[model samples]
Target: MNEQLTEQQINAAGHLTIGGCDAIELAHKYGTPLVVYDVSRIRDQIRRFKKVFEANQVDYAVSYASKAFAAIAMYQVAAAAGAHIDVVSGGELYTAIKAGFPMDRVSFHGNNKSADELAMAIHHHVGVIMLDNFHETDLLSQLLEENDAKIKVMLRITPGIAAHTNKYIQTGQVDSKFGFDLASGQADEALEKVLANPRMEMLGLHAHIGSQIFELAGFEGVADKLVEVASHWQAKYGYQARVINVGGGFGIRYVSVDHPLMPEEFVDAIIKAIKTAVAKTNLDLPAIWIEPGRSIVGPAGYNLYTVGSRKDVPGLKPYVTVDGGMGDNIRPALYQAEYETVLASNPHAPIEEHVRLAGKYCESGDILSQDQGLPATKPGDVLAMLDTGAYGYAMASNYNRNPRPAVVFAENGHDQLVIERESYADLVHLDRPYEQQ
Candidate 1:
């Protein structure tokens, strides 16, 4: 599966160095179980995606889906790279606001937004609010009318195109919880209700099929379906959606078994599909928007863990335990996903044996990798797992009283700690003891 490290990434000590910082040194300074993001790689990815849209003559808004990894530093980096932010929750919105992200460039999305959340979005003057259902539309309209605020909104529709990915992430299917159903005439009704609201300006239609999708055909399918609905709206009401957001599910190369399409190629293919569909529909081209979370930041991140324990299971396999487990990375146990790992302390070591990577969690199922071939590992050896920036920390848990790991950025030979390691006291910071009378 070609699990060797790149030559340019190898350092004098025979260890992998990302963003000009040695992984081993980073582990020592930031402590074990650290997430190190390569800022240059993230910026380059953003530019590559944007360039393809620009070249294809597609007016687009490339929003970084911040649910992948939302932090002040990450938000700032994404904003600085000229990518609009897509926040899915109130907390994500707060983070972006604290990072001083331009509200005009931010888009808020959620399936069930509370009245307070709607009010916050109105106060912040976010660029767009992607309404997921009739309830949200009603709530947003009420808030806007009561507060005398006008909002730009997009109707999120389920296009009934089931993407090839984990079933948990599929959103465009008819029965999915995310968007308005397109097959049952509910989407039309929702559109009618949205248009009736005087305070809300319906800007567009948005659809996200699923996540971890590897082929471009699925996206093409989404584009076709969206254009079909968009044409109907134009014909019925003479109101063409100004923007069409085909939400992002561009996959990444998690292991050799998966061959994900490149970001630029995926974007180009989607653009071509949209143009073809629009040509047939005889409708004006709307500004296309994409919300890419994983592809933009996944490969740019590497999680370093210090080996802590070793176990030899008779007639089964050897187990190498690290300081972190499902608490930090739940993909392995959650999705039965595979990840490639290399020894940061000995990047050039030959793969000599197969070992199961276990996390330091109480659950027996808290494993990081199963039946993985790597160099004979020992305690204190640093292991680097590639492509962890997307969901690793964002989905992290405090299970088994394990504190979350720290996050850092390594760029141009300089390493800066972006998030401090959670301390034991930080664990119970929200707890309070009751005083008995």
Candidate 2:
């Protein structure tokens, strides 16, 4: 029931075509359980964020949170769009580097970054390091001093304001394990330590409230809190914050009932709050940087699955199974996430009835969605799930020995395979044979 699909998605010959390519055809070519991203949609999102900041006549940087879908192709796409890239792990950092992304535009983030990881970031001369806690501050300081390096850093602070999202995804709340807490005076301690360290250049402050945030008040609350902290620090230490990396968690429409703000509207609201806070605190406005992961790629991503088996219940809910399930997208099982499903082979057909979408996984709770209406789905019918572009692929797993599906980027009537589907051999490539031992 969610109208979350991209605008460019159309019905052609009674089949779904995303970005001018038939979705069913793409499944046949790339194989089922495929993730097809509309490249134009992604580019549009990048441009949307840029236009919003530029329109406000403010210094800003839009960094694509690559943890949503850490693919080399996506990194290249972000780079081409003139957006910075945010890598949360060594693997993501390596992927961004391998994609030939500008090292100076890459930011390394994680609460528990290892020594090797910090060294990797320092070695590559990454643009900024979003330090999450005291452990990271000490580890990174030691690593930088050891290497005789001075790098730009941002202290990830917990503004103690919780967004109205799922509690599991909330990060900026006081009880969260992510950043320096403001209420306990940990933020001030961390700021002092960073300023006293010669190897660390405190560029700004960072705070991520939560993902899938719909209310603008949460954004404004954090902005106000962070600016207040910045003002205090500026006065106490005579150190001016140059940038404020307010981490992104803007919610996207997954179901029809969910009404989230547009990119421009969201950016405008946050900027207005920052301006007000800056004026109230009598502080200089710092450059705003956002790391949007879901909003940028959520609607642009469509997941295609091949119908497999079905179980009829006569009166109770019938079960419709797909070739891929929680293995390819664990959100439904993990977060009880809901999605709108359409028959790619017959998208325009009249609705027949509602059926429960069952995953091939062995778990009983591997249901993608319950009571989803479709046009008389049958075996071999291609089912496309809307708005799966954010955490679906990033959270995919190899549970039950199911190989992960391939990913493709579609645009201008063509599709490019970005990630190859896993093979049976690949499943055990790292295993040591008992016979060998």
Candidate 3:
């Protein structure tokens, strides 16, 4: 059972421990269907990414793309760890503002930003606005002109590099709904428009290849393309762009089949590629910015659930149903993602049996794991799923009218409940009952 735990995690006293907290005990005290985050692991990941920038001797901003899992507490933690933040919508920006995050350290990004969103960002004095399309540029330009505010902007470009990942998560390819496409000259046209606007400051270019990418080749390819574009721009314009944001889609290992690069290796590969391309093109190093979401927080989170019922399908498979399902974690149902699970109450048990992990949701598609190996499972046993820190709670929905799970932070043998469990009344708080007159 201990062998099944990740290198940074441990199992003690027939209980799972993450960042040194008893998982069973945490579930017992905090209640089942809980998201427990390892504070130390989050800090360690932040430091690891920062060290990469330091090692490369490059001015960089490692922005935590909170779209992975954004909450007030998580935003504050990222800010305290000395990392900038990336918010895609007004809701995330509002949460960050409520957390009192530094306005100057925030970067706003979106393909379809509303006027109110742009106004909020300008009022907050956000550091950069990552323009996604021509409409967004025009809208932001109008907002800036009206407010008479100076805003730094980065042009998000699709470099036509399709990374090896799920097609749904790939963003750098030609067909993506994200950045401006480089091959069709849309990226150049976008840059020209931004440069023409006095209120909109053309900082640099940004390109994101994809999500959950295991290899570094995609990043290297994008870096080469972006640097070439930047050099060409520098020759046309008098000054070299001051910033180049290689957007974040670095991968994290969710199970045995997935193998993502470590922070050091990923950063080193990008830096080497950028250096080579810049040297080859005779251009100076521009400030680098990365918007990593899953990699920074995925492994740091664990979803703790308690087994409620067990059923064996004759000769097909055994099903272990937990109290929570798609309402708390929808990745399995949405993307057919696979996850590894362990019985926290029987850490020493030999995993010799295969079981299908199911959630309590009424939907048949609410399966968490299919044919997952585990020690013989029993009713009332506590189980934990690893690498859920990214899309788990962030993508949670109140399907089947089930309330979402609570989130906790644990470190140094101490655990604190950061988010209170949602109640039935809380779920309907937004509803207004009306009687026919």
Candidate 4:
């Protein structure tokens, strides 16, 4: 049995259940390579993060990083959960607008934001623009002056502390490509620039350590570093920050070996660290904002794939191929990501053999799992891949001209199709025959 599943997750038919809906039935109805989300899981994680801040009597915002998984339905669900959102691209912002989400609750972020995207964010009155570079700062300043617009902004600084990654070195120089480096005084330089522009309201500072983080030391280091920066700005420039955003990268359980802290634990630690840091300074306690993309939706999502063929190599792990491949979820092929899989019909069945879970994509690297232990499964057996809700569909492509899979939301014994499967015509909808002159 997969450790991620509980006894209650198995229905009377001996099949895995998602949000009270049977996984087998979902596969039959939606077809293979489908993505399913347990809506309650997302809702609960958001609420839990909020309650922790509220319980501590601290003001906060649980901003969902939409880049993890962006769609109109996802935006709607996030809005319903009272979550602010972080959008890196215009398409995600447009999706949130189409979902009727409040624009003021949106934060636009990107390393190199286009002029058009900045114009869109300002025109729509997005809550905050995470200024990443001096070029972007100048561009936004010019655009704001031309449009006579004003918007709240934050300086994204590289605190140089990342956990569970090779970039864990914390110093003045950062190895990332995202934000302004603090050690080089670029963060201070950017701040002075933002303050010079009347159209940009400098709210506070922002930093993202790393993704798939499992430890708290990195976050604690960042919390203290952000406060140190804020204190320096307040003392030197007489500037007071209202909000401190330590950007998202919270980890979630993709396999049994992963043991991430609860959302409450992570929030509580951050809150305490900020409070403790504030006690050492004359500055007021700023509102803490956390962006949790993977933690909020990763555990809630599952990918269902239907088995198609098999190849038994001599004395090697048998190849168990499925209908979907890198086109649907490219994490495995791109970065050698790991995930657990189970038979939808009997999630708790005894392991019969170890097989390589291969994808149907043409690429030789389209392997879903290198060594997946599973029960005896024949053709047409549905395999439920766990913890794929974060980066799966968001990175899906029309590789090999395969249409992306549909997405479904299940809760309280009901299932609703949120995103429809792309049609074959959709693959060529943007095609135009070249006319040689």
The lDDT for every candidate, in the order shown, is 0.90, 0.89, 0.87, 0.91
What's the CA error at residue 81 for candidate 2, in Å?
A: 0.2
Q: Using lDDT as the measure, which candidate wins?
A: 4
Each candidate structure's TM-score, on Cα atoms with residue i matched to residue i, is: 0.98, 0.97, 0.97, 0.98
Off by more than 4 A, model 4: 166-173
- Local accuracy of candidate 1 as per-residue lDDT tens digits, 48-115: 99999989988998999999999999989988999999998899999999999999899998899889
* Per-prediction tally of clashes: 0, 0, 0, 0
In lDDT terms, how accurate is model 3?
0.87
RMSD over all Cα atoms, model 1: 1.2
TM-score of model number 2: 0.97
Q: What is candidate 3's lDDT per residue for 325-398, written digit by digit as tens?
A: 88898998888998888877666668888888999988889899987888877778888888899989999988
Clashing pairs in 4: none
RMSD of each: 1.2, 1.5, 1.5, 1.7
Cα displacement (angstroms), candidate 3, residue 380, comes to: 1.2
192-271 per-residue lDDT for model 2 (tens digits):
99889888888999999999999899998988888888899988888788988788999888887788888668778898
